[model samples]
Target: MVDLSQYLPILLFLGVALVLSSAFVFLPMIAARFTGAHKPTAEKLTEYECGFPAFEDSRSQFDVRFYLVAILFIIFDLEAAFLYPWAVSVFKLGWLAWGSMMVFIAELALGLVYAWKKGALEWE
Candidate 1:
């Protein structure tokens, strides 16, 4: 018999989480109904973004510069994500990890400089 007693705490935690999540999601809805605050108004339902109606086509083509910015953001964001875990354990990892991290940073720095030189950072 596989002794599943060791997994009892994990199962209990998951069960509690499920109950709390369900309560949080349903309680608000039930309270709103009972409190008479669930009335729907046309103004409340309208889009309030930019405080004006959207005049442009929703599917309009975006500029390449925006895409470039997004790609750069993702690249640097992933670098930060990788750096955090590596930073935490680099001391135990020794010189090879340190050297590799430095090389990775240098490559990213070079790419950033190249983008700067090419005016890819400019939004206008």
Candidate 2:
């Protein structure tokens, strides 16, 4: 028989994690039931954190500008994320890496100018 002792710790760890997670999730539910706070009313069911119920259908179309802004934000955010690592390693990587990073920045600037001229930055 294959020695199963080596797997005992992993199995025990998973079993404990399962029990703890179950208690954490269900304990609040059980406490609420006994604390007279389990009541669910129509208004509570319909409530929103924004203090206003949703007016439009859930599947209504979003504005094109919303997508444009999101894409631009993600692009620039990724550029910043990459820039930090390149900055840290540029000396070790020599002049080629520095030149490539400069080109990347130039391309980002060109994209920004294009978006600005095309009125992608405008709202309404």
lDDT, candidates in the order shown: 0.96, 0.97
Candidate 1, 1-124: lDDT as tens digits = 8999999999999999999999999999999999999998999887788788778988999999999999999999999999999999999999999999999999999999999999999976
Number of clashing residue pairs in every model? 0, 0
lDDT of 2: 0.97
lDDT of 2 at 69: 98
Root-mean-square deviation of candidate 2: 5.4
lDDT for each residue of candidate 2 in 32-105, tens digit (9 for 90 to 100): 99999999999879857878878888899999999999999999999999999999999999999999999999
TM-scores of the candidates are 0.60, 0.63
- In model 1, which regions exceed 4 Å deviation? 1-51
